[model samples]
Target chain A: MRKNDMRPDELLKMDRRLVLSATGGMAAVMLPVVLTSFIVSETARVVAAVLVYAAAIIMAWAFVKRYVGILNAQHRESEKKHLSEIAMLVQPITTHLNNRALIIPVLTNQLNEVTKQTESAALDIGEKFMSIVQRARNQAKKASGAFGRFAGNGGSSSESLTDLSKKALSDVIESLRDMVGVTSQTLKNMEVIIEDAGNIKRIVTEIEYIAEQTNLLALNAAIEAAHAGEQGRGFAIVADEVRKLSDRSNAAADDIRKLISRVETDIKGIYSKTEKSITESSARSLEAETVVNDTLRKIDDVIGEVKKQLDELGAETESLAKDISSIVISMQFQDITRQRIEHVIEPLMSFKAELEDITQKARSMSEKIHEWEGNSSAEWLEKMYTMESEREVLKEVLKNG
Target chain B: MGKTVLIVDDSASMRQLVSFALRDAGYDVIDAINGKDAMSKLNGTKIEMVITDLNMPEMDGIEFIKQVRNNPGYKFTPIVMLTTESQESKKQEGKQAGASGWIVKPFTPEQLIDIVKKFAR
Candidate 1:
């Protein structure tokens, strides 16, 4: 393995192996040289050989120790370089994770605030709408009540318009009948007056007849006075005066009879005209009564229609109020939606917390790369199952698997 | 005077929704955030009924119902559990804790009012 990739303990074991192999090879070579010198049987030569071997063995040991130290120094340098590279790579990721962790909570909080405000505003609008609907219902009820009072329905004490109109027409018809009765009575009186005039005419005729008879008697007396001559001369003079008086009486009687006839004719004409007028007035009065009754019937029909329409209006307003109330009830869905949103936000918060934990671990790992060992699979798996759905899925998978 | 009901839930929206439904149904309503808050609000005010959610912070519905049953004044008051939990075991737990009725979440206003009328009456 590359020195930087190798663990410090593995590098230490390799260094120990290299030092043992060098010492064993140097000992093999020195032992043989010392054996050969001892076999040569020369003391001075043997001593010099031993001295050279000792110096050579010391020099070899020193060289192996220095080489092991250089290898260890290189391994330390490589380890430092690897740790620096890991820190460089982890810095940006840690920062990104930290930033996301910080932002998620704020974002979720803002979302929660917005949701609350929207819910409140929507609830307020619903309340106001309900208030308006209630007010409208009350107003409609008031209007209907007033109309009922005007129509005299529902035990109102005041007379209805229909009743008032009928009553007024009835009074007019009664007055017309009264007038017809009076006119008929006046016509009957006129007839009676005409009959009395006829009686007076007959009386005048009798008077005329008496006056004629008296004149004749006066004429006879004058004739008798003439037949007795000279002694009857005074009586004849008186008789002549009586005869003149009788002639004037006859002329006045004739004038009186003619005046009575003219008076009877005028009375008959007045009676005929008044009787015709009374008949025509009675007919007109009946026709007017019929017309008034028809008008009253029409007024009743119109008022009945108006009252029906008002009742329908009241019913429709009540139905509308009920519909608005149902709408207000339907507004409760907002609460359900809000609960669902809360469910969603809970997992998001878990994810944010998990991310923050990972970032902290990453920072610690970067600082101690040489000593760092990554998290376990189970630890990561535990974090992955933050939501209930995810945990359910995992359960399903385990059951199936 | 209308009967009073208390609603307890961690969700504000849910509390408001229950409050609105109860108030519209001609009953007075009081609301609390959780079981602990609900416990504090039960100060001998003659609450006829209680509606509570299953899960909450600090204290939960089961424990809350137990506490309520311990109170002498509210021992007979009807307590209904309103929750998203549909598990039979959880329901049994709630029943054992003295819940009078159980209602799943997303309930209609009519259903809630009907339940209230039945139990509160």
Candidate 2:
């Protein structure tokens, strides 16, 4: 029968007293005949009456034994029915507890494995985070060091590199200007020297003209002296000497004129070359300055970019370090979580233990109930006591849970 | 020459992390799976410093430190322990075994590097 359909009180409510009372009434009716037969007996009759009374007593004893046997059979049948009902009441509960006990270990093992994996994963993540942040910090420091060294070379921190290069270029240009000025002055001096040479050539020409006239005057005086005879001879001699001296002086002036002409030619050639050289050098200088300024500007742009990158790297490294630290702290949560899981496992284990106790009790109680129904009354009562001990254990499980 | 550091840990990920960090900081790194592996790698190789985990299979950090200290070539080498064990007694055990210092688990990269720089160089 279903546990819900079987009531213990209803099973135990059977009345055996009605059969006992009917047996008692049958015995009382048979007793009066045996007493009358004993009262009328002579010697032979007395023996016969005694025999009838003995037979009646024997019949009454058999009837009482039969009634007791019928009652014992009914009691045994009732006990068998009770045992069946108790087994039905406990079977499902025992099966349910057994299944729960079987599942608990599996669940606990899975939980432990998950907790272990989580801890491992958290530690792994923490390590990776540390590595990344460390790499970033190192790179930042390197870049910053390189940038500092580069910028430090410029001396004053506030000075713009472009301005420094510009100032250097301006100095070079000023020197070029001084060189150009000196070249211009040298050309002017060459011009004045050339004009002085032209003036000397004209003076030499006038000397040559004076020498020719003196020679012509000496020729005329010589002819007049010849007509005057001896007095003219002395005058002719004086004119010849004066003509010779004048010719010599003209020859010297001619040589001086030729030297001045050569000197003026050389000075003119020098002035022309100097002027061309100055022009070429000035053009080259300006080209060089432009190239230098362009280069400086490019260098300035590169430096600015490098500095900006270094600054950003520094900031990023700082941010990464903070992020890594936070992640490292977060890894601690795994430890706490594992501990919490352990706490959960503890209760689950206890529950499993209690369920196992209950299942054992149910199985034992069912076995004892079977033994009680099969065994003699004395043996059945002893087994019933053992069943009560099992019940107490099950009850304890229920109370603990 | 770049500075060389030995990183010993049972966890492959942890070893990778430490090696990467040290390499990034311009130091050359030698990786070992455990203290025993670290011992094999240390033969005749010049190591400036060592970073190891305390709990590991085969050989632990304390014993590794002791072995490193006993080696004539690495007598003065600095050894740092990286571990989950935070107890003072455990720390003392490592220290007694010749560890230069110790860092708890989940330590920041910066903290690790700083210790490395101080001890390694």
Deviation in Å, model 1, residue A116 alpha carbon? 1.9
The TM-scores of all predictions, comma-separated, are 0.64, 0.54
* lDDT tens digits by residue: candidate 1, A295-375: 877766766787787778777876765566666666667766776677878998999989989999999888676444222
**Candidate 2: regions farther than 4 A off:** A1-90, A101-192, A195-305, A308-401, B1-106, B110-121
Judged by TM-score, which candidate is best? Answer: 1
What is the Å distance of residue A44 in model 1 from its true position?
A: 15
Residue range B6-91, candidate 1, lDDT tens digits: 99988766776677667767899989988999999997887999999988889999999999999999999999999877899999
- Quote the lDDT for A146 in model 2: 65
Steric clashes per prediction: 0, 0
TM-score of chain B of 1: 0.97
Per-residue CA lDDT of candidate 2, range A366-395, in tens?
A: 988877765544443443444678767655
What docking grade does candidate 2 earn? Answer: incorrect
